[model samples]
Target: NRCEYCGDENGPFEIHHVRKLKDVSKGTEKWKQLMIQRKRKTLVLCKTCHTDLHRGTLPDNRFAA
Candidate 1:
């Protein structure tokens, strides 16, 4: 499959989590459940797009707060 962001099908791809694990609260059960649910939400991105995403250059809607 192609990357959802840049549509690159070249090299390797990575599964980028829509919600960061660190942002989820670990103290509450509800938050924990939410964290688990969030884990299932991910986006496939190419290596370049993934790097751009982490560098805050790619304007992916999934990473928007």
Candidate 2:
């Protein structure tokens, strides 16, 4: 399979989230908004991109304009 974020076809991959455990009733964050819009909680991502995500190092364009 490929990473949903980086499109990396790598094994030993990790899912960003398993389910929407936290609240998103009034989420203004891009990621949270994306999740709400898509009605999906999971994001298949490579290790590198996943780390960059948690670190908030990913570029704003990653989410697109």
Candidate 3:
């Protein structure tokens, strides 16, 4: 698959979310929403891109610095 960030064609791509459901809701709501939004809401990204996205380094980084 092609990575959503860098367009790298690689094996074992991961699902990258715009906003993690757990970050929005908690407990039961988190699980329910996550399950419902798992597929259509994620982008396919490579390992490096996935790590950067959550590591407070990428341009679209989601983690707190």
Which residue pairs in model 2 clash with each other?
Answer: none
Error of 2 at 35 (Å): 2.3
Candidate 1, overall lDDT?
Answer: 0.58
Which residue runs of candidate 3 sit more than 4 Å off their true CA positions? 18-40, 60-65
**lDDT tens readout by residue for model 2, 33-60:** 6667767778777787678878978554
Tens digits of per-residue lDDT for model 3, 5-62: 5667764688866565455344343222443455445667678767765674555332
Q: Give the TM-score of candidate 1.
A: 0.53
What's the distance in Å from true for residue 54, model 1?
Answer: 0.7
The alpha-carbon root-mean-square deviation between model 2 and the true structure, to one decimal in Å, is 3.3
Could you tally the backbone clashes for each prediction? 0, 0, 0
- Enumerate residue pairs that collide in model 3: none
Candidates in order, TM-scores: namely 0.53, 0.62, 0.50
By TM-score, rank the candidates, best first. Answer: 2, 1, 3
Question: Which of the predicted structures, 2 or 3, would earn the higher lDDT when compared with the native?
Answer: 2
**lDDT by residue for model 1 over 1-65, one digit each (tens)?**
87765567775989777465555445343323444565645667788777876775665343312
Error of 3 at 41 (Å): 2.1
